[model samples]
Target: MSLQWTIIATFLYAEIAFVLLLTLPIASPARWNKFFKSKFLAYISGQASIYFVVLIGVLILCLLDAIREMQKYSNIESTDHQHLDAEMQGNMRLFRAQRNFYISGIALFLLVVIRRLIQMICELAGLYAQSEANFRQAQSATVAAKTLLEKQGAGDEVAKKDIEDLRGQILLLEKELAKEKKDKEAVKSQAESLNREYDRLTEEHSKLQKKITIAGGDKKDN
Candidate 1:
């Protein structure tokens, strides 16, 4: 109740609040759900550390100020030193401080969350590979099935014709696959080349536009 004790209490509570802020929004099932893997959370942890360090720097300054105040009044032995008490009371608990820290920590988490989202995007890249793998497996199975069918009807003219038909179909499939591969490569290459040319032309056009503007301005001034 005395002034000295009140100041001390304020300082003590504020420090406590700061600490609580760092630890809030603790690890939870929902937090884990936010990220698909441990690495994502780990990245967030690193950012949280940075934010804590920064925010903590301010809190530390407050602490140092509290200490400086103590020193300023240290010589005043006869004074009640009640200000220290008020500071202690104000700085002791950190529930309020923790709220802001948690907010910053969550914002930093978004940086890592974006990285995770990118990884999710990269995962889609494997779809093309999986499709190719499936196609190969299916082709292999088809050949196996055709082989079995031919073996069962060996020496029959009708079976020979069926095998030849299957072979022709398989050849067609192989050709189509090759064509698609060629087309994909060609398109990709063309796109890259076109992009390069577009960039160059755009730069040139920008320069030309600047020159035209300058020339027109001179004529108008004349």
Candidate 2:
């Protein structure tokens, strides 16, 4: 039982040392700024460091008291079984106290470690969510831009088709204009021909009238 108690004490002290080492950076005022970004963290670290110091003092005192008790017990001569039983009872009480102290210390250390881990996890998750939101926004913008471009392309195609239709209409109008001009030229040529025929017939009629008058005069003289 004594040996077991000693082993438990040794293990508890070792665990305490390990926890202290792990907490050293958090507890150190000089190093606090490196890990913590908030005043709240600073305040929490200060409080936690004070608690850890008090717990260390208590554990040290308990270990010292346990050592003293063990020394005293060893010095006692085994006079009788009743005395032995009393000593055993005392030892049992000490063991129980030491066990409770070790358990509480370990629990406190684990709580602090777990809290820090959870904070880190939450921070990481927040960063990931923000990045994912930004990425989704960018993706949505890209899709919208693509959709806008497609609409513009469709508008351009429609405009080109309208331009082509306008060009075809212009060509048809030009052909009709050319045909009207050609018909107008044909009508003007036919009118000029009719005017020349009227002038030749009037000249022939005047010559025939002169010949008839001369013939009648000759008959009268005879």
Candidate 3:
């Protein structure tokens, strides 16, 4: 029984790990287009949450079935009970240990999901900070270029050269600003994806709650 349980646990862990490994591309900014990365990650996270609930429910059902079977085997045959047999007692202990192991494994898997979520948040924060710094630097460079252009006189050759240099500087700053805008757009796209996911999950939860309430009322009426 222990060996069987060990094999089952190993298989479940491997499957969960494989699903988690698919999230690796999310860490790379280059992997993000307008649609793929953020949407994919949100989908995976939402699916993971759904599966987590399902797996927990299955685990509980399995536990309840096991307990029911154990009770059947433990039925007293006479006025005085002899207690459960040694083998049955040992099997009970094994079942309990395996159940605990499975519960712990599921908890660990949840922690992995949460850790990945936190890591993603931190990465976004870092990227936002970098983008802000780039914007400020670009703004300062633009101000410097305007000041230089204003101070120069249009007649002197040296002043013409200075103006040309400033013009070049301003062009470079504009290119940098364009790049920053692109990055900002990418970030905005991701934020919108997250918002859409939040709305979807909220709607799903509300519907689920209503279904549960309706089912409970039906059960009481029956």
Candidate 4:
């Protein structure tokens, strides 16, 4: 093979290796994202568009050349039937042309495939990051809700305790009020009995004074 064909063959092999590595499950999406974002890859990516166009142009030219060679050799082999040596040479050349055609064609196809694979990997990485962020937000919200519920529960317990204390105080006040009523009734009954005794003594003293006056008047007359 010529030096140029040899280089193209090497590039094709490299492309195959890249495809295999890309499809393997050796690295996660995050790791692939990191690798793609690295400084070296970033620098390469800056010029990747230009590089891709140039490489495609080269491949197309090589494919065209291979096709022309294949047609030329096929014609020669068919027309020059009497010259066996020339026919053999043409056959060999045609075989090389066909080989080059397959190589360039496959390389071009793989190039596009690799680009698409990279894009898919990038999109997958973005989705993974977004999902992780959403999961973290959900966890934080759950924690916050739990904390709020706990606080409300504590407040409810405090309110219940206060109500119980107020109820106990009310019961004590009612008992005190009942005791005060009993004391007032006892004092009222004692005052009524003292008033009755005073009336009876006054009536007896008046009757005794009237009897003495009558007896003295009779003695004076005798």
Candidate 5:
């Protein structure tokens, strides 16, 4: 094989190996995403579109050349049967052309497939990251709710204590009011007894004065 054809064969084999590695589940999507986003790959990816176009164009040209070579050799083999040596050389050339055609076609196909696989891996990694963020948000919200409930419970306890204090104050005021009412009633009873005693003393004094006046009148008449 010529040096050019050997190099193409080697490139075709490499493409096949890369395709197999992508299809196999050896690495996770996140790992693949990280690898593709690395500095070296990112630099290569920056010019990936140009590279893709150039590679595809070269492959297409090679495929067309191979097809033309195959057709030309086939025509020569069918028409010039008298020259057996020439016919044998033509057959070998035809075989090489066919091989080249297949190699180029397969390499082109695998290139597109590799690009699609990388895109899919990147999308899957993004989805995983988004889901993790949502889960964290949910956890934070749950924590906030728990804290709010704790605060509300503390407020309720404080309100209950205040209500108990007010009830104690009311009980004390009722006891003081009852004691004052009893003292007022006792003072009223004492005042009524003193008034009655003064009335009885006045009546006795009036009777004594009347008796003295009656004794003096009897002496004067004697």
Candidate 6:
């Protein structure tokens, strides 16, 4: 049981680190994009933030239960029940870590997460705009490519114009693809940050639950 939590803690930390490092920059450009522009993205982020808040509540309940159980276990055991004592210590550490973490997460959700949500909406909006532009460009390029084919043996002007149009279309697509990739990276970064916050919350929740169990146990014995 102890080892399981240790593993969870380690994994959650790494997840947070990876996400924040990658996503925060691309969407940072307020001029390039404006957040809250995409209602869908904003809504999704809001839902996620709320989910975390609910999770924190559940953790509190579980924590109470664990503390209660611990009380009984601690009192009923023999003097050598050092195992219970040690486990109790471990549980305490988990609880403190979680309490601190979730508190921080709540702050972040208010500030960073909400901000990120806006950024995501903006990014999506930008991508949509870019896509429409690309479609128009592609249609124009297709017409050029067709005109050139119709006058296959025509002057250099016809051949050159066709080639130029095609080249422009390809370049435009490349730029669009690149922009799309950047947005994906930005999304990844946001996910990573959220994941970190999630881990912290989960750990804290678990710790509180253990305490609640222990506390309940103490009550029962008395």
**Of candidates 6 and 4, the better by lDDT:** 4
Q: Model 2, range 50-111, lDDT digits (tens) per residue?
A: 87677566655655665666555544424445666787876676566555455545644554
Task: Mark the regions of model 1 whose C-alpha exceeds 4 Å error after superposition.
Answer: 1-157, 218-222
* Candidate 5 Cα lDDT to native: 0.87
- The Cα local distance difference test for each model comes to 0.60, 0.67, 0.66, 0.92, 0.87, 0.64
Task: Kindly list the per-residue Cα lDDT of model 5 for residues 1-222, writing each as its tens digit.
Answer: 788778777888898888788779998888889999999999999999999899889888888888898898888778847677777888899899888888878877887888888889899999998999999999999999999999999999999999999999999999999999999888888888877877887888788888999989999999
Model 1 lDDT tens row, 1-222: 345434444544555554454336554323434443468666776686677567556545544544554454443434555687664543442332333334334434443454454454346435655777999999999999999888776758777898999999999999999999999999999999999999999999999999999999999999
lDDT of 4 at 214: 94
* Candidate 1 minimal-lDDT segment of 10 residues: 92-101
Question: Which residue pairs in model 2 clash with each other?
Answer: none
Residues 51-110, candidate 6: write the lDDT tens digits: 767755644554454455555444544345458668677567556555445533444444
**Which pairs, if any, clash in model 4?**
none
Q: Which one is best on lDDT? A: 4
In candidate 3, what are the lDDT values of residues 1-222, reduced to their tens digit?
556455546656765775565456644433332223376777776677687677666555645555565455445232254556855565676566557456445645655564565556557766876998999999999999988876664446777788999999999999999999999999999999999999999999999999999999999999
* Tens-digit per-residue lDDT, 1-222, candidate 4: 999899999999999999999899989988999999999999999999999999999999999999999898888877837677777888999999999999988988998999999999999999999999999999999999999999999999999999999999999999999999998888888888878777888888888888899999999999
TM-score of each: 0.26, 0.53, 0.34, 0.87, 0.75, 0.30
Sorted on lDDT, highest at the top, how do the candidates line up? Answer: 4, 5, 2, 3, 6, 1
Clashes of each: 40, 0, 0, 0, 0, 36
Q: How many steric overlaps does candidate 1 have?
A: 40
| Ranked by TM-score, top first | 4, 5, 2, 3, 6, 1
State which candidate, 1 or 4, has the greater TM-score: 4
Alpha-carbon shift of residue 153 in model 2 (angstroms): 0.8
Cα lDDT, model 6, residue 8: 39
